[model samples]
Target: MNLFNANETKAQFILSLLPITLFFPIGIGYTGIVLFFVALLAGGQYRDKWQAIKDSPMFFPVMGLLTVTCCAGLLLERPDGFWKAFMHYQIYLVLLVFISVGAGYWQQRALRVFFAGAVLASTLLYLNAFQLLPDWSLFQNYRMYAGNKSILIGILLGIAGGWMLNQICANHGHKWLRISMWLYVAVALLFLAKTRTGSLIFVFGCALVLLRYLTFSWRSVLLVIGTVIILGVAWQTATGFRERLVGTVSDIKAFVDGGKVSADGIRLEMYRITTDIIKEHPVVGSGVGTWAIKYPERAQGLMSAEMATPHNDYLLYAAEIGAIGVCALLWIWLTQLFVAIKIGGENGMRLFTIGIAIMFGGLVNAILRDALFGIAFMILLAIPLAGISRHNYKSHFGDLDR
Candidate 1:
């Protein structure tokens, strides 16, 4: 037999529980270290995936340099403070880069596994709301949880929703099953207003994708209207669950103290502070870890301290480094995604479709919060980016199966 199997069993195994474990999820620390070694054994005994990682055109050395520059500057300004922020979180970022390189070897399957892990994590977390699972912390000490159970559920559903939608069109016989599952997911999602932005964005994106498949003849339009009316009528008559729905709305009202414009409606303030800070530290940046202390003026606008991260990733990069840094990071992320989309467009790889849908939510979520800075996102997202390089290296050898 040849060395590696047709399936990258080792890598798949590594990633299988990764979604739940990659972050500071409870039980992921030493356990991850053990699993990581197991991944090496599973990934094949001898080879390093380094060369494959270096080939990604979008892997921006400049952005890394920029981050280091900012971090270094922070150290120079105040070593005590800088060490706290950068010292703890940066390791996950580095680990992701390494794992993604391996992903390059077999890009599509690798992605499926990663997405599967993410979905599983979301599912288990949602179950916690119903007491089906325990609320053990992800990143035990590092609880940078972004969305609530319902919101996270919706986003994961959005992810699976796209896959299900693709299967509906691409496959036969399993159509009803996928549709039924999505219907349940949608109903569950409707109750998740705690994460209004995440839930709504996901639902909207899925709806847009599904709209493409609709048979929009007059009959179809009438059918759609009738369906909506029936759901509404049924919803009203079904008073059994009305209190639960009302409780959800009431909780949402309490959350939106400032008119529920989303994220406490301080994104504009974040934008203002980011712009002012950039103006002050134009060239090399105020450096990492310094923003929270140095920019208190910006954060504590009309109310108390606004937030730590600027929320928007583009802005956060700017805050960390400079315009050049932000641009470099965006360049790396977008260029790779664009190339991947093109390749998918030409070859009919469904991964391209799924990635874009997830990325849209990621992009929007990034606009509202700092998931990228979080431990789980760094490890999970970085590896995929690095994997693109392996893909490039494979391209040069005229090999299609990799």
Candidate 2:
């Protein structure tokens, strides 16, 4: 019995409760995305339907890479265990993408306000993470928020940055709003810098995008962003940033050369093993779930840790399904970036999406830590996407925007 189509008024009533942002049904964000897409499809919407999803100019080519990669993985690796895990991966990532495209239907005004709320939500959580505020004991125990500081900060700043830029674009008739956005940037930087080691640098990346919108003169904006980057790089180097990045590896020369590092080490040893395995089975992989197996010893000796999968998400993809699998993963990323960059007229929603892609897309490295972060960044970023026109809803049968 499909609750969406069910004749029972009670079932429809329950369905209505699903979209409320107030009731963030934890552990079920994926379900929300899926239902939203189903609602769009079943409602019989049609205004530039295909254009909305996979929006980038080069989206089709990226999708081609994605399809080819997944095909190779499935054909080369016949492991049932890998299949089972991959099925789950597909379900969530697919829905996450759906949310991205579907967000365009949400409307320009609501997108900005909704994303502002999202930024507030992220800021509060981050403050908690720093213990400047209350820590979410639940998140600590659940460990689902993707233990990745860089990605989190990036998403927070990116969304906030986008919404702020959208305000500048919307030309809210107040010069103060633009100044307020710059202030928002400062607050965003405080949180981002404190958390991620590389994030301080990423701020320049954010500045570049902000520059584009800061002045109508694209060239001037570029110059401002470029100057900031040059200064940042010089200062970072003068202060021995390269050394600071060494982190746990700094004290341990052996690990740097041929000894051992750790998760703080980014568990590079696991990556070495995964890469080696790929060499032996380049055409396919050891199997999806099989990465959990013990890695063969390197020249030094037996591997130290018994990590099931490579810590790096992309490497995990390549290892599980080989080159083809990695292609699929990259394809999804490329497609997302393209769509986020596409302009949807003079509205806050387009600006917000572009900003998010910048902040989140720039740190593809975080995917190495948690696939969930990647998904969450893409998924939650949708709140700011412009809504479909009422015309499209009529095409979708009876789809209601509310």
Off by over 4 Å in 2: 1-28, 34-66, 69-74, 88-110, 122-154, 162-172, 185-189, 192-194, 197-204, 210-256, 259-263, 294-308, 335-371, 380-402
Residues 1-402, candidate 1, lDDT per residue (tens digit)?
123445555554454345444423334534764666667565663435544434554445434744665555645454346656554324334444445435433434434444454445445445654656544454222122344333443454555444444445434365566556545544444442234444444445455444544585774465346436634653565353354446546545654553432434455545666778878777556666666776677565543265666546565556656676565555544554565554442122233443454445444345323333243433334333444442442231112221
| Most TM-score-accurate candidate | 1
Angstrom error of the Cα, residue 265, model 2: value is 1.3
- TM-score for predicted model 1 compared with the true structure: 0.64
Model 1: CA > 4 A from native = 1-11, 20-30, 41-48, 57-79, 83-154, 207-263, 300-306, 345-402
**Residue 89 CA displacement from its true place in model 1, Å:** 8.7
In model 2, the Cα lDDT at residue 300 comes to 34
Question: How many clashes in candidate 1?
Answer: 8
Candidate 1, clashing residue pairs? 10-42, 24-138, 24-139, 25-138, 25-139, 56-389, 100-383, 100-387
Residues 1-402, candidate 2, lDDT per residue (tens digit)? 122333322212223333233213234545654665576566554554455554433345445544654665556544445555555345334433343334322333334344454455455544655666544543331123333543444444544544454455444565476546544554444432333432343454445445445666775565456546644664465344344456645535656588656545545656667678778766565555555553534423545354444546666666666676666566555544444444333332343354444444433343432444444544443443323332232111122222
Model 2 whole-model lDDT (C-alpha atoms): 0.46
What TM-score does candidate 2 reach?
A: 0.61
